[model samples]
Target: MSSGDGRAPGPLLLLLLLLALPRSAGRRRAVVNRSIPDVCATCHIHATCQQSGGKSVCICNYGFVGNGRTHCQDKDECQIGASKICGNHTLCHNTHGSFYCVCLDGYRASNNNKTFIPNDGTNCTDIDECEESGLCGHNARCVNTEGSYMCYCNDGYKLETGEHSFHQDENNVSCKEIGCGSPPEMKNGYIVGNYSVQPGSAVHYECREGFYSNEGKFSYCTENGTWEPATLSCKEIDCGKPWLIPHTTMTWDNSTTLWSRVYYHCKEGYYFNGDKNFSECTMDQSWENITYVCEEEELFSNLSIFNETCVRWQKKTGRLGVQEMYTFHVQGQRWYQKNFFHEMTFELFTHKQAPEVCLDLQPGTNYSINISMVALNFSLLVSMTTQITDPPFPEVEFVAVKGSAPLLRLRKAEDQNGPISLYQVIVLPLDLQSTFICDSFAATTFFSNTTDIKGYVAAEFQAKDVADNMSIALGDRHYYGKFYNAPLKLGQEYCVFLKIISEWNKVRTQSCVIWAQIKNLSPSLQYMTAVGLGSVAAVCLVLFLSFSVARSCLHRSVHPPPAAVACEAVHLSTTVDVASAGIASLFLETESVSLL
Candidate 1:
């Protein structure tokens, strides 16, 4: 009835038609849901699908279908595409109609034909094989490959990991060789080392035999190109001991070194030979080139005569016989035996010989000998002597006269040897023993004529020698006489005497008296008688002249004339009147006058 065609359709046909319509609708949906159209069409055909937007429309092959909209998606072969996945090293991939996966090198798939889902290619990073233990052998370093690791060796060592091979051969890891060079040696007292030492490195040492090092044993190389702390040392050389001989002295400058100076000196009374004072230690360790002298005291003899003589002379007459001469000798034998005078033991030499010896040894004319001595060594000692000689005596004489007193004359006395000696003339009264009169008699050779006896008061006189040895009294020389005309008061019985004396020896001699009686004389009286007569005559003549003058004056007074008398009276009256008038006039003018 709907289309009135074919007698009524069968049920099977009707059922087939119904199925075809739903199927076509579902195919359209699959194609629309697939994302890439060409990729989905790789395995599917006769599928009506359209791509609207960015999705594909298709029918899935076998066990695949579109999830929704237009894309075709996988259906599980085991679950999804698990049966078609690659091995353990690979990742599984699914397509619209089929699926497949491949493994990387050095890896294989597991026996089960299932897909492998890798954990993550980018998630887990590779491990460093070089750092891991046992990755390389001893003395070796490890390096990593794409999927594994290997080992290489370092210097001075061999790798014992893979095979038992020598380090120097190929395929073996080995280290290069290294070492420290050499040990140090010693020379002289110093230890020396030659080595390539690094900065801050150090070395140690000790001293050699037969020598002792004063410094200690260690040294170090520092950064400043010098050794630190110190250096090794050897002992110093030793020499033998030194000494000086007995009774000698020595001195050294320094004790530490073998070089030294030695000074030597000998004792008293001993002498030394060549370079006796100094020596030195030479390089051979021996004292060399020595120096030396002995002890002495020096002896002295002399003799001479000692004596002198002196003589004097008179000054006025130049007479020599009037003076005396004296001689004396000085003698000695040894220092203690020196004697100025020795009458018994000493032998006296002549004045001539004595003078010759003294003059030769005299110091000079100005110097004289005062002391003399003889040394035990026969040395003669002489000094000057000073002597004073006595002055000459005086001479005197007495002379007599008739009317005057006696006088004395002085002269020098003569000594037969030479000059005169000093003399004194002394007078003393006969009655008065204590009354001594003195007079100086000058010394001379000739007699003096002038005398000095004006007073004649002295009674006796004496002449004395210069040495006071002789007097006129002892000689009995006639030197005085009595005066015949002497005055009576001077005494008529007086006695007089004269004496000559030598003062040096106190000698005197007296002169004998010449006695005489003194006579008295009277003056004449004729001049007294003439003077008395002449005085009487003069008195008588004066009296006679006085009597005559008186008689003449009496005769004239008795014979005057009368007329002459009258005229005389008148003249007197007139003169009297005139005088009275003048007096009146003077008195009237002046009332009073005084006369003295």
Candidate 2:
């Protein structure tokens, strides 16, 4: 049997309904009740129940969508995109009952958690990897991006490995300062000053000696971390072929550049009469001018020296008995006297086959004689030596000083008379000044005690050691040669003598002069004595000036043209002979000469 709502009922439920229906009489006349379903118990597993209008109702959960009582299912919140649903830089994931927000790569949750639920203002922000120092290695810069960061080298720097960018963990990643390691080398050139590898710096260059350049002399560091190639060019300074000089043969190489030399020598039957034997290439691109001449040699034979002061030479047969004018040039020197020099030239008229000339020469001297005959175009050279004689008298300026030793001047003498060997300074008691002999060697050194106690050798000097106008102090306590210049005794009167000695070829000679006299030596009166001596010297100087002026005037009157003595006659015949000689031969020999 079915119930009243079309439901079949069991016998038990039918009997219960029959018993409850007849017992209601008047109060229960047709009394009936309806049963209501429980809405909470009929809800879906993925849904929840709630109250609505004071009655229980069924609804879907956060991540579910359905008619709550019949069925409920998961709704994909990520279908619309994580950026719109969960927030920017985030991912939306749906669970059975709900959805959550997670950040993407290189981003983090703003809520400081790994995951979050949205709708509470939670979001994802860019993770700043650059915030950590040294994220990029040295010399590199770190930059942040939307979700990441990049590393780059600074200007004027480059990656050591040649990469454009790097990170700190990369092996050997370094940003090294840009450099063109060393500037390119230039031929015959050198760097001028300091240089750096940094961008925009420059290296300067210059050509070395004997070289030059007109091109760029700089190499610059560019922004690309490399040097701009150098453009400087160096070239050797060539002076070109040297100019030819007449009557000479050159010894040279084929180079005509700076400092190159071309040596010159006179050919046969000629003599060099120039100060320089070589010409040099200069920086002005030319060979320097030289005062070089090759004089024609005269025809002479059998040249001989006689009487220690005369020369003779046989004339050429072609010029026999022809009245030829001969010139004699003489030069004298003494080996022991460096200050001595004698030079003279004279003319002689001779018609004899053999010409002879006697010279008035100095003693203890070496002489060279050159004889030239103009007509014959030939010459002869001869040497001679003179025997030693007594040395010339010593020239001195005598001084007398009281209360102090005097500083005396020594004037050097020329070796016109003899070769000067030694100079000696002798100190003696004033009483012995009259007994001093010019040839005496009895004076012992100041340190030596000898029988002649009245005198001692204060100083001695070899002629080579003495200079012109040298000064010597009387008691300076210095040594000259092996003799000590000892201090003088107080209150003693002394005499000083200068002696010159000459020794040559088993002959010895000497000369002497009184250099100074000191009387009543006293140190206390030195300053006062100097003042007195100054006054006397001033008067003497005035007198000397007056005498010199008068003497000069008298000398000028005696010789109106003093320069005439140094003037020499230049023979026109000699010049004509030299000019007429074979100029072609000079050019022929010059063809083989190379410029250097």
What pairs collide in candidate 2?
A: 3-7, 24-28, 297-378, 298-377, 298-378, 298-379, 299-378
After superposing candidate 1 on the true structure, give the runs of residues whose Cα lies further than 4 Å from its correct spot: 1-180, 184-203, 207-216, 220-596
lDDT of 2 at 268: 83
* Cα lDDT tens digits for candidate 2, 1-596: 57789867888988998998777664554443234567899999877889999988899887888999898888888889888899888888887667888999889988899989887898899999999988887788999889978789998788878888765654667788887777777789999979987788999999898987767899998877778878888888876665445456889997888999999888787878879988898765556767676667546768777877777778768767789898777877665554566889899998889877889888987766666665665555555778887667778898999988898888887665677888988888899889877766633434543333567778888887788889888767788887777778766899999988888887888888888899998755654575466556555655665565556657667665645323311233343334434332222211110110
Query: lDDT of model 2 at residue 562?
Result: 44
Query: What local distance difference test score does each model get?
Result: 0.37, 0.75
Query: All predictions: root-mean-square deviation over Cα?
Result: 65.9, 33.7
lDDT of 1 by residue, 77-193 (tens): 434333234323454566555555644432344533333344333212334444567545556666665544555554433333424333222354543222222334554444446
lDDT of 2 at 219: 92
Whose TM-score is greatest here? Answer: 2
Index of the highest-lDDT prediction: 2
